[model samples]
Target chain A: MGELRRDPVRNRWVVIDPERPDREAALKVEAQPPPPLSGPCPLCPGNEAMTPPEIIAFGESSRQRNQTDWSVRVTPDLQPLCRIEGDFDRRPEGPFDVMNALGAHEIVIESPQHLLTWAEFPEQQLERVLRTYRMRSLDLRLDGRFRSLIVVKNNADAAGILRHPHSHVLALPFIPYGIEEELRGCREFYARKERCAFCDIILHERVSRVRRVVETDFFVVLAPFASRFPFETWLLPLRHASDFGKIGEKELVDLASLVKRTMQMVGKVLGNPSCTIVLHSTPFDEPHTHDYHWHLEIIPKTAPVAAFGWGARLFVNPIPPEEAAALMAQQM
Target chain B: MGELRRDPVRNRWVVIDPERPDREAALKVEAQPPPPLSGPCPLCPGNEAMTPPEIIAFGESSRQRNQTDWSVRVTPDLQPLCRIEGDFDRRPEGPFDVMNALGAHEIVIESPQHLLTWAEFPEQQLERVLRTYRMRSLDLRLDGRFRSLIVVKNNADAAGILRHPHSHVLALPFIPYGIEEELRGCREFYARKERCAFCDIILHERVSRVRRVVETDFFVVLAPFASRFPFETWLLPLRHASDFGKIGEKELVDLASLVKRTMQMVGKVLGNPSCTIVLHSTPFDEPHTHDYHWHLEIIPKTAPVAAFGWGARLFVNPIPPEEAAALMAQQM
Candidate 1:
C-alpha cells in the first residue's frame, strides 16, 4: 500500500505511491521500439491471461471472464497505485498528516483489438466505452470508502507508456483539491444565482458562439474561456447532470459522437498530438445538487510544461481560446 | 500586449500571450545543429547588442550599460509574455473577468562566458547570480504596479528552449494562484499555531533529520514532507524572512553555496536531468508579516506529467520523499 501525505503549507494531498514501478525504468521500457502489432498485448484479445482477473467485461455473456469476446473489459491495475484491500488508516506523522492510499486502480480496456488510438474507434464502440465508464463509476461508488472517481485516458505514448487504447478509473478516498475547488466555485455561483456554473458557461458559450467548436443534440464542445493549454477543449452536456454515472444511453451515445468528432478535429489541426481526456464529475456520496455540472476535458500535449507553469500555477497559453475554437470549428 | 482571462469555474487567471513566438518554431530553431559555442552566442561577450538594451548590468563600472564587461546583465525579454507599458485594464466579459496581461518579463544573463548550466559555476559566480536576483527583485517591486515577482530558472533543454545559463524574473500585476494558495496556507497555519508554518517545518526537519538532505550555516535543504515530484527539494532560510529581496550579503553567499551544493547532489543522483528552480517569496505589496516564508523549490524533470496530474491537480509521485532524500544525501 502507498501513503497519502499532505503538504504542510499547501494543504494539498500528494499520493506517494512508492509501490509504483520506477518511472525511469518505465520510460526505458516505453522508449524501446514497441513489438510488432501482432505481438502479445495484455489488453488485446486472447491475451486476457496476461492481465489480472477481470472484474467486469461487456460481452455476449457476463459469465465468461477474461475472454476475447469482450468489447470493453475492466481489470485491476497490474501495479496498482493504491490497493483496495487496505483501510485508510489516517494518522499524523509529526507535523504532517498521512493516510493509507486506499482505493481502486483499474484499467478499462476500450477495445478488444490493438487499436492504438481512441479517435479512430467507431462511434458505436466509443459509446460502449463510455457506458463502461458509467457502469464502473456507479459500481465503485457503492464502496463507502471511495469519495471520488477520476476517469482519465492517456491516449498515446507521449501521455504515458500505455500504447493500447484504455482509460483509467481511480477511486480516490478524498476529493482531490482540484475537484474540490471546482465544486466550491460552483456552489458559490449557485448561492449567488441559483444556477449551475457550468450551465451558465454553456449558455454563455452558445450565445457567443465564438468559443463554440461543435455541438450535438445533448452535448456542446467548445474551447474553455481560460484554457491553460493550447487546444484545450471541453465537452459539456446540455442537460444539468452532476454525476457521470447518471448519464442515459442517449446522452452517452451523443457524448461518444461529440467526443469522437472533437478529437478528430483536434487531431486534424494538431497533427495527432498526444492528449489526455479526463472526465470530471460530482464526487461520490455527494447529493444530487443543482450547483454542479459534469464535463469532459481534453488537453492536447502541444508543449512541455516549463517552470513558469509549475511554479506559479499560472499557465501561459500561446493560442487564444477564441482562435482555437474557431480553428476547430473550421474543421467541423 | 496579452490578456489575462479568469476561469470562472476554477477562479484562476491564465495569461494568453499571443505575441510569444511560436513554441514549435522555437523548438525547430533549437533542433538545428547549434552554432559553435563561441559563434554569435547572444548571451556571451561582444553580443550585448544581440539582446534588448540592457536594463541593468553589474561589472567594473555600474554606469556602463549594454557593454561586454558586465559579469551579470538584465534585459527585457525579446518576446515578453506581458509588457510593462500597459495598464491592467480590468473588465468583465459576460461571466468571466478579464484584464490586460500587464507586467514585466526580464532575463538575467548569469554569466558572460555562455556557461550552459549553473551547477558547474564556481561558488563566487553563483553568489553573484543570487545577488542579481535580489537586486532585480527589489528594483521591480519599487514600480508599485506589480504584485508578485516570480524568479525561476529553466535549466537545460528539457526544461525549455533557452540554452544559455540564465534565469527569468516575471513581475505580475496579480498574485498567481499557486502563490496565493501558499500564502493562504501559511496564514491559516499561523492563525492556529501563532508561528510561521515554514519556521515550524524548519524546526521539525532539523529535529527529525530524516528528510534533511543538506544543512548549511544559514539554510537547510530537505525533501518536502509532501513533495509533488521525485527528488523535489526545498531550500529554506533559517531566519524568518518573508521576502527574498531582503537577503543580506552574508545570507546571499550562504544561500548560493547551499543552492549549488543541492543542485550538485541532485545532478549527481539524477544524472544531470533538466530541472526547474523557482523562488517563492511574499507578494510585493504585502507588508512584512510572519504569515509567509520565502524558499526555493527545485523540481527535477524525471518523468512527464500525465493526465492524472494535470486534471486532478493531484500529483502521484512514484518515489517517496524519504527515499529520494536518502538517495541525494548519499552524495551530499
Candidate 2:
C-alpha cells in the first residue's frame, strides 16, 4: 500500500503508491511509438472522402473540388467532447452547479501534406493556415451561444497522440472557471497599477533579459519568473493586442517567421521536443474592456512530475528559467 | 523542431522537450535494484549515526536523545535547498535576478523499523509522528526571517528520486507568488461570505455526496468541481481547523488510520498507482484568523501534459470527477 504525502510548502497532496513495484514500468504502457511518416493518413490531402466533411477549405487558384486541391482544411473532430448533433441539454443537477457539455470542437488541418508542419512550409502556405484560424474564429463568434472561442495548436508526437501537426478550436457555451480566474487576476492588477500585467511582465523580462529564450520583430519568447515547470516558455505579442483575430497581415507574416525561428531554436536545444502553443485571447461577444493580453505558451517535456511534486502540488524544478534561457541562447 | 501549440481552454503554457526523455529511463540507466532491507540505509532506524544529527526525535520520550532508542526521527536534509550556513544575498546582476536560496529543508524519518508507514503503524506510533510535526512547526515559526514553512511527504519512487517512504519539511524566506494569489482568493471569498470558503465547500460536498471519495471519523475526501486532472482528490478535516500543528492526540490517531484506509482503497483500484499527497497549512508566524483551510491534495499519475494542455494551461479530462468518484467508491 502507498502512503498519502503532503507538501507542507505548497499545501498540496499527492498519493504515494509504491505497489507498482516498477514505478518506471508505467511509462512503457503509455509510451506509444512514433507513428510512421509514410502512407495515406486520412488527414492528408486527396483523402477528403476518408474524413468527415470539411467545414472550410482553402485550395489553389481555380480549384473547386473539396479535398484534392486544398491547402488548409477544417473539419469536425471524429471523437469530440461536444457532439455537433446534440440538443445541448442544460438540465440542472443542483444549485450553484449547472451541467452540460455544450460546445463545438473542430480540428484544423494546417497543411495538405501529412509530414509537413506550418514551420516546415513556405511563408505563403503558412499565412493561409493563419488565415483559416482567423476565419474560423470570426464564424464561431457569431453563434452568440458561445461565451468563448479558443484555438490551440498541440504540435509534435510528444505533445499529441497523432503525429500529424494540427490545431484545435473550441467554442464553449460557458466561460470556463479557469479563464474567469485569470481574468480576475489580470483585472485586479490592471485596476491597481493602471497598466496591463502581461505588458509589464514583458517589459520586465526585456529589461532583465535573463529569462528570454527567443525573440522576433513582433513577439518575444521567454520563461516566466514564477514558472510552474522547468523549460516552460511563452510567446507574447510585443504590442498589447487583446484579440488574436485582430492581428494584421504584416503581423501574421512576422508571426509565421518568428514561430519558425522560435521552433527552430527550441528544436536545436531540446531535439524535437513535445510542445503546445495556445492562443490566449479575449472572450467572445464581450467588449475588450479588461486587461487580458493574448499570448501563446510552449512547454518542452524535460522532467517528470515525481511523487513529492504530484502529492504536494508544489513543483521542484532542477533547472531555473534563467539557466534554461542561457543554455538555449548559447545554442542559438 | 516542436512548434508551440495552444489550448483552446485554460491558457497556461507547457514545454514539450523530447531531449531529456522520461525519468524512467534514468532509473534504468542507474540499474539500481531497490536497496536491500538490511545494512546501512541512512533512513533506516538502526543507522541513526549514518545520517545528519537529529533535529527532532521521538519514542522513549519527546526529549532529544542518543540514537538507538528512537522510534520516530527528524533531521536536517544532508543536501538541502536552504542550507543552515548561507549568506542572505538578494541582488540583481546585469539583467539577471539572483537571491540566496534561504529556507529550511529537513526530513522526517517516520518509523525506526524502516518498514511501516503511518497507516501501517499502531495508533500510539502514529500519534507520536503527528506530535513531532507540530513541535517542528511551532519551533520553525519562531524564525522571524522566514515567510512560510511547508512540510511534505514523498513516499513512492514517482514522488522523488529516493525510494524511501519519508516526508520532508521546508521553510522559505519568501512567500511564493502562487501562494500569495491563493491567499488573496481565500480572503476575497471570506470577506464576502463572512465564512471560510473551504468551510463552505466542505459543507457543500458533505451534503451533495456526489463528488465525495471517502469519509472517516476525522476526514472527508472529495474532488473539486474544477479538477484539472482525472482522479484528483482532496482529503480535508470534517471540522474546521486552520493548522496541522493543532490537531489533538485523538484526532491524530483517527487521521492516520484514515490515511491508511484511503491508501489501501486507492491501491485496489489503481494497482497502487504512483501518486502524490500534499499537505497545506498556514504559514509560520501568520495569524490563524486568515480564512485559510489547510488540506491535503492527492494526484494520481494518470497521464502526461500533452501539447494542448501544456500550451494553453487548459485541461481536457475525458473523465469527470463525479464519474471518477463513483469508480473510487467501488474500491472503498
Candidate 3:
C-alpha cells in the first residue's frame, strides 16, 4: 500500500514505495573486476596516432599542435553529439520548435597515462588543461554559430558509473532555457542592487563562513543555500568574471590549483566518489550576458535522485547545504 | 575519455562515461520478494489507522477515525516536503533568497493489497482509484492556501526502490516556475493563432495517425514530437479539457479504462517494464490556464542521462517519438 507522492518545489512527482530493502546488496553482487584493456586506449599518450588529429596539446614549454612529447591532449570527439556541418536550421513547423545541431563537441585527455585521474595531474598539467579549454572556447566563439561553450568533467564511481576520469567541452548554438533563466535572475538582481549577485553571495559566505566547503586564492567552493540536490556544491571565482575562457594568465594557475585541490578533497571526503563537474560559461553569441557570472557545479552520487525528485522537480534535500558544507570544510 | 554533452531540444545534459563498464544493464529488474509486512506498511488498508485520517476512499468505506474496508485511500504525508503551516516567509536577506516551506503533501494508496499493481486491478476498481484522485483534488483546492495540485504514479521496478505500487498527490502553495514557463510558451502561441496549442497538436497527431501510442473514448496517448527522454509518452484527452480534476463521471470511467489499458499495453510492449507516470492539472491559484490542457507523462527508464544532459539541462533523444509509438502500437 505504499502510495505515490508529489513534491511541490520543482512540480515533479514520485511514487513512495513503503517496502524499501537494504540498498547495499546490489553493490555487493556487482563489484566485478575491471575489464582488461585491449587494443589501443586513445587516452594513452603512445596511442596518440590512434585518435583524431590533436586539436591542441601541451608540450615542455608552450602550446603544441601534435608532438609525442606532450603532457596533455585535446581532440575532436570520435562520435560527436553535434557535427560541424549543416545550415543552422531555423524553420518551425506550426507550434513545433526546430533548430540545427550547430556546435562543436571535443574530448580532452587529461593525462598521457591510462590510469591517472584528472586530479592526479601535476599543477603544470592542470594549468595546461585549463589553457586548452580556454583556447577551444575562444576559437569556437569566433564562428558566430555557437551561442556558448560549456566544459564538463565526468568522474565515474561517484556518479554510479564505471571508474574513469576525463572531462569534455561542447560549444552550442543556443543558450539553454535553464541557464537563460539563471542569467535573467542574476541580471535582474544586479540591476536592482548595482552589484553582481554571485559576488554578493561570495562576500556573504566569506563573512558567515558557514557554507564554505573549500577556499583557494582564486576561488571558493561552497554549497548553495537552496541546493537542488544533496551534497551539491559549487566553485565560484573570488573575482567577478563573466566568462571562464577569459580568465587572466595569473588567475589560471590559481584556478587550476583550486580545481585540483577541490577534486582531491572530494576524493578524500567521498572516498574517490563518482561525480559530475560542469563549468557554466556565458553564451558566446549573446554578448550582453555580462550579468551572468561563470561557475562550476559538482554533484556527488551519494544519493540518487529518486522518482519523487525527478517526477516532481522538487528536491527532498535530506542534508542541508550548510550542513554539507560544514562537513566538507572539516575534511578540507 | 568520458565527456559531458548537452542535448539541444530538451535543454538537458548527458554524460558519456568512458569509464563505465556496464553500458547496458537490465531494463527492469523483476520484483523481489515483498518486504515483510510487519513494519506497518504505510499504504495498506489498516495503515489508514497509521496515517492522517483519510481524505477520500471507496469500497465499503467507513468514515470512522481510523477504520479500514477501503480500496483506495488518500492521506496527508507523514513527513511532508511542504507543510500546510505558517505564512510563506518571502524575503531577500541581502543576496540570499529565503522562503518558508508552505504547501500540502499527501499520498494516494492505489490499492488495498500490498503487491497488486494498479494495472492488475479491474476496470471499476481503476475508475474508483481515479475518482479518488479527482475528488481529493477538488476538495484540496477549496483550501485557498494551495496554488496547484499534482498527482503522480511510479510503477514497476525501474521507477521504484520498494516493490509495492503506489501514487502521490501534492497541493502546492506556489505555481511552479517550470509549469509557468510552459503556460507562458503555450499562451504566447495562442495569442498569435487564437487557438489552443495542445488542440492543434491533437489534430496533427489525429490526422497523421503516427506517434499515437494509445487511444480511448476520452483519452489518447502519444509520443510527443520533441520528447525529452527516450520512450517519453503522453496520455492526453481527445477533447480540449484543461482541468483533469474537473472531469465528469462518464469521462472518469473512460479515463480509468484508458489508463489501465495503456499500462497493459506498455507492459506487453516492453516486457512489463517500469516507468514513471505523472499527471498535470490546472493551477488552482492562477486563472486563465483554461487554455492549457491537462495530461499525463509516462517515461520509461531506458537509458541513464549523462552529465551533458543533466548538467547543462539539455537532452539527447536517440529514439524518435513516432518510431517509439509505432513499436508500442505493434505490441498493442
The chain A TM-scores for the candidates, taken one by one, are 0.86, 0.83, 0.84
Model 1 over residues A1-332: C-alpha lDDT tens digits?
Answer: 22222221122322222222221221112222333554567788888898999998888864477767888899998756667885656666677656666678899999876755767888999998998899999999999999889888877644344578888898877776677767877787788888887888899999999899988899999887776666789899998989998998888888888888888888777767777788889898885369888899898776554357775675565566777888788887
lDDT of 1 at A311: 58
Candidate 3 Cα errors over 4 Å, as ranges: A1-40, A60-68, A157-164, A191-194, B1-40, B61-65, B85-92, B157-161
Native-interface RMSD of candidate 3: 8.5
Provide the lowest-lDDT 10-residue window in model 2 chain B.
Answer: B1-10
Q: DockQ of each model against the real complex?
A: 0.19, 0.13, 0.26
Instruction: Give the Cα lDDT of each candidate.
Output: 0.74, 0.63, 0.67
Model 2 lDDT per residue over B1-332, tens place: 11111211122211212222332321111112444444466887667777788887776664446467777788887556455556656565432244555567788877776554343567676666667777787788787777676666643434344555667777766554335445566777777777876777778778899988878888898876556555677788888887877777777777777777676665555555555666777766674455887777676655553334443344555445666677678876
Instruction: Tell me each candidate's TM-score.
Output: 0.88, 0.81, 0.87
Which residues of candidate 1, in runs, are more than 4 Å off?
A1-39, B1-39
Interface RMSD of each: 18.3, 13.0, 8.5
Model 2 DockQ class: incorrect
DockQ of 1: 0.19
